[model samples]
Target chain A: EPEVTQTPSHQVTQMGQEVILRCVPISNHLYFYWYRQILGQKVEFLVSFYNNEISEKSEIFDDQFSVERPDGSNFTLKIRSTKLEDSAMYFCASSESISGRARDEQFFGPGTRLTVL
Target chain B: EDQVTQSPEALRLQEGESSSLNCSYTVSGLRGLFWYRQDPGKGPEFLFTLYSAGEEKEKERLKATLTKKESFLHITAPKPEDSATYLCAVQEADSWGKLQFGAGTQVVVTP
Candidate 1:
């Protein structure tokens, strides 16, 4: 089965440095999303992208965070000036459609573990 | 605000045992309820999606049922391979693709 793929399974970065997490969602998927999981915490939604634009974002997706579909298959999330609290597992997901029943189920990538020191 | 609460944070089951995991959610307008399985350090794997109340779906030994306020994942005759963290998430009707997730229930099946 086709699955979402992410680059750099693990990343180590220093505080105040920038990091870009990349994902290639399932082929033919139309909607993409970014979510994070802090250690021992629930998965939190960051943002959703469709049609080369942001559909919705959470408070956690503040000014420092940005997402881009730099190419047809590459979707990237950039964080400017990472903080210690930013250390978490960032996941990328995609879905085929959002309107039909049960069509919104998303498939997630293996996730990129970001460690900020 | 949407809130998802899962009961019994951890469960230990013997091989061939059967049990259920509960996910209760509060959302403005329910668009869909999803169930995912996650192993340690891995992303969630999609299992089933329940769109409306009274809807149910089954896959292998796993069965998921949805109600107006809660959803349940029943594991029947589970094996050691069934051990994993089961995650439940919700999507609001008015939202695009954002999913609100619960803390998840970790299951351990021993032989």
Candidate 2:
């Protein structure tokens, strides 16, 4: 089965540095998303992209955060000037479409663990 | 605001034990209720998606049931391999592709 793959399984960066978490979603998926989970918290939605443009974003996806397809197969999340609170597991997901009944489930990548020092 | 609350934050069970995890949510016109399992250091693995009250779906020893206000995931004769954090999420009518997730229920099944 085709699955979403993320790069840099784990990353440690300085508080003021920029880090990019990359993901290659399933080959044919059209909808992409980014989500984050703190050490012991619920997974929170960050943003969603379709047609190479952002469709929706959460308040947590503030000015410091941005996402881009970058290429046909890659989706990336870049956080600028990371803060201590930015440490978490960032997940990328993709879905072929959202029109099917019980068939449009999102497929998630293994996740990238981002640690800000 | 939409909210999802899961009960019994953590649970421990012996091999072959059967139990259930609860997920309650408050959303406007629920589009779908989803169940996922996650191991440490990994993303959530989809288990089931319920679209309406009285709907049910099953896979091997796990069974999922949904109602208007809550959902339940029942595990029958569970094994150590089933030990994982089970998460519940909801998609409201107005939200497309965005899921409001619960904190999750951690299950530890010992041999």
Candidate 3:
């Protein structure tokens, strides 16, 4: 089955450095999202992208965070300056449709583990 | 504010034992409720999605039911391979595709 795939399974970055997490969502899927899970914490929504623009974002998705559909298949999340608290597993998800009776069940990628030192 | 709360942070069961996990959600307008299974260090794998009250879905040995206020994931006669963290997420009707997730229930099944 087709699945969402992310690049650089693990990343090690220093504080104040920039990092870009890339994801190739399932082919033919439109809506995309980024979520993060801190160690021993719940998965927190970061932002959702559709039509090449952000649909909604959480408070944690502040000025430092940005998402781009740089290409047809590539969706990326960029953090301008990483912090120690930014260390977490970032997941990329996509869904086919968002309206009607077809519940938009998202499929997740393996996730990219970001470690900030 | 949307919130998803899961009960019984952890559970241990012998092979073939059956149990249920709870996820209570508080959202302005419920669009959908989803169940996902996550292994250590891995992203969540989709299991089931419940759209409205009185809706239920089943897959293999797992069954998920939804009510007005909460949802339940019932694992029946589970095996050791069923061990994983079960995550529950909710989407609000007007929130587009953003999902609010719970802390998850970690289940460990032993042979």
Candidate 4:
């Protein structure tokens, strides 16, 4: 089966530095998302992207966070200024369809472990 | 705020033993409830989606049931291969397709 793929399985960055997490969602999928899970915490939604635009975002997705679909397959999340709290497992996901109030299940990537020091 | 809480953070079951995991959630205009399985160091693998109260879906030894306030994943006669962390998530009508996930329940099935 086709699956979502993310680059840089793990990353270590200095506080206040910038980092970009890249993902390649399933080729035919339309919607994409980013989520993070702090150690021993629930998975928290960060943002959703569709039609090359942000559809929704959470408080955690503040000024320092940005997402881009630079190409047909590459979706990326950039953190302008990493903080200690930014260290977590960031997952990328995509959905094949969603329309007319129907919900389409999302497929998740293995996730990138971001470590800020 | 949307919230999801799962019960029995961890569980251990002998081969052939059956049990259930619970997920309780609060969200406005719930669009769907989802169940996923995760192995260590891996991302969630989608299992099922429950769209309404009283809805149920099943695959292999797993059965997922949903209600207005909670969801249950029942494992019947499980085997060692069933050992994994089970995650439950919810999508609200206004979330724009973002998922709110619970702290998963880890299950260990010993053969």
Clashes of each: 0, 0, 0, 0
Report every candidate's CA lDDT.
0.95, 0.92, 0.94, 0.92
Model 1 reproduces what portion of true contacts? 0.88
lDDT winner between 1 and 4, please give it: 1
Candidate 1: residue pairs that collide: none
Classified by CAPRI criteria, candidate 1 counts as high
Deviation (Å) of A67 in candidate 1: 0.4
**Best prediction by DockQ:** 1
Candidate that beats the other on TM-score, 3 or 4, i.e. the better one: 3
Comparing candidate 1 with candidate 4, which one achieves the higher TM-score?
1
DockQ of each: 0.88, 0.70, 0.83, 0.73
Local error of candidate 4 at A97, Å? 2.4
| Sliding window of 10 residues with minimal summed lDDT for model 3 chain B | B1-10
Ranked candidates (TM-score, high to low): 1, 3, 2, 4
After superposition, the stretches of candidate 3 with alpha carbons farther than 4 Å from their true spots are none
True-structure RMSD for candidate 3: 1.1
Docking class of 3: high
lDDT of 1 at A11: 98
State the lDDT of candidate 3 residue by residue for A1-117, as single tens digits: 899999889999999999999999998998999999998999999999999899999999999999999878899999999999999999999999877268488999999999999
What is the C-alpha lDDT profile of model 4 across A44-93, one tens digit per residue? 89999999899999999999999999988899999999999999999999
Interface RMSD of the candidates, in order: 0.8, 1.3, 1.0, 1.6
